[model samples]
Target: MNGSYNLSSGTHYGSIGTATCVTGYEIHGTANIMCDNNGYWNGSFPDCIPVDCGSAQTIENGNVSSTGATFGHTATYYCMPGFQLVGPNLLTCNASSEWEPYEPNCQGMYPYAIRK
Candidate 1:
């Protein structure tokens, strides 16, 4: 979250660039800066914090249960009785505030099989 900015040796003025943060962390302020007419860069560096994924969506014929709505958190899927889960049962919130591994679906399972 906290770090220092390094300037390459022999750097000249009027240079513009962007700042970046490590995974699972996000910038909390301006991410771009530029060297002024002077020899110094403008604006202070931003801080990084844990990414936050607001919430999960409700799946068809099933329910979504989550441990937390942030980075590294999990969202679990559940199907009702006689229903079949068509995809993965778990999704994780990533650094981009998104649930990984696409959402799941619930398909009805009949009690008996029929054939011609």
Candidate 2:
């Protein structure tokens, strides 16, 4: 849904191409397709499924705000009063089905860093 796909050659009887999802998305079906002798694609058209990074973990002394875990979605972490956030505070689902910049942790304002 994020982008479009292209074929390597003409849509002839023996043409072939690779179906790939754009960045921040993923393919849920076959990546390779071939034009068959019957003037049809060998397989069903692939679907560009949104990448899922799953749910964010609970952070001590902090709160997480996420629209959704699917691709193109964002998750932001914020520390409560008297606390600070460590690592990247924002994470976005990427095409590889992972969160960008990794997940962050929260720590007390006046103590050693705590990872959660």
Candidate 3:
């Protein structure tokens, strides 16, 4: 269960003003969740941007997914062996209501980019 969040307005108390914007997933077994400001009452931190998973894609472990500005967000992804993840390894809901930036890369290797 790995996740990342951005601190937004508030004093870490239970209220609309206090919320942490989450930008990652909390995958627990068959359940995949994205944290939002809803955690305030539960004493969970919120993020700057509301975590909204628009679509789902499947990818194996050791893969790379990239996206452009058309995609609302860009993410780095990874998976486990034997099992596969169903969703963009790195994804963002695009302006056209499309999960951009990519279709998902499958393989076991290093994901790096060379500066030209």
Model 2 C-alpha lDDT versus the unseen true structure: 0.81
TM-score rank order: 2, 1, 3
Q: Which ten residues in a row have the lowest lDDT in candidate 2?
A: 1-10
TM-score of each: 0.66, 0.72, 0.27
Q: How many backbone clashes does candidate 1 have?
A: 0
Write the residue-wise lDDT of candidate 1 on 10-74 in tens digits: 34676655667778778888876778777777886788777898898888889999998888999
* Alpha-carbon lDDT of model 3: 0.45
Query: Which runs in model 3 stand beyond 4 Å of their true positions?
Result: 1-54, 62-76, 81-89, 109-116
Residue 29 in model 3: lDDT: 28
In model 2, what are the clashing residue pairs, if there are any?
none
lDDT of model 2, residue 76: 91
| lDDT of all predictions | 0.81, 0.81, 0.45
Distance from true location, Cα of 90 in model 3, Å: 2.9
Name the best candidate (by TM-score).
Answer: 2
